[model samples]
Target: MTTEHIDDSAWISDKDSPVVARLSQLISALTNLTMETTEDLQVANYGVGGHYSPHFDFYHVTIQFIRRSCQIFCFRSGNRIATWLTYLSDVELGGATVFPMVDGYIVPKKGSAAFWYNLYASGEGMIFLRFIALN
Candidate 1:
């Protein structure tokens, strides 16, 4: 996976990027949440040595987000929410995105995407969102 940090306000630009832009818009539409609430929606490309360790999406509560979220409650209650993950490219092997629960696994399809949501809440009654690419 290739990782690069950017300023919080950096705009993403790339050819054939409309799918991701649409996905982001859909995310905003699906929930009352806003991306601005978080520092930034950092984007990365994963291929080799790119697996993400199991972790929570949000580090802590923020006044900009809801105190509790359907995401958390659904996860803890054994329910599932819809999340959208778009792949920028294809890999030969070992790059599926995996979640510890329900054996969540999605293969990379260039310009395609997957959707799922977390159902667990945080200690402070907050919601979390996270994902990783296995490479």
Candidate 2:
């Protein structure tokens, strides 16, 4: 996995910021899922040559079993069901989200968002829905 820098302070609570609250509401509305089931917003900053390797968002059976005793918060909520990614800034070059299985490529554009289901209705991870950062 490639290293990425995340602004930990960016996990703004809805009560702390009206913008965050509105965004959360919008996401809940778009996904038809309650905000209670969603995780806090994450902001990752990538510099030149930064990238993320392909991976699934949902937890696998083995992972769930291993983390069950240690992660109470995760178990209480559930595995990730969906992903809603919003690009904050435009990249001049080599910053694309690629899904190899579907031949999908999304260029990073400011204010653009991408949404996808990480699991099926039956709660199985969608193995084909993996993304890698090409930068």
TM-score, each model?
A: 0.49, 0.82
TM-score of 1: 0.49
Q: How many pairs of residues collide in model 2?
A: 0
lDDT of 1 at 7: 16
Candidate lDDT values, in order: 0.52, 0.77
User: Per-residue lDDT for 93 in model 1?
Assistant: 69
Candidate 2, residues 46-135, lDDT tens digits: the string is 667777777667778664355554366557767888988888899997888899999998998999999999989999889888778766
lDDT winner among the candidates?
A: 2
Q: Candidate 2: where are CA atoms >4 Å away? A: 1-10, 62-73
lDDT of 2: 0.77
Winning model by TM-score = 2
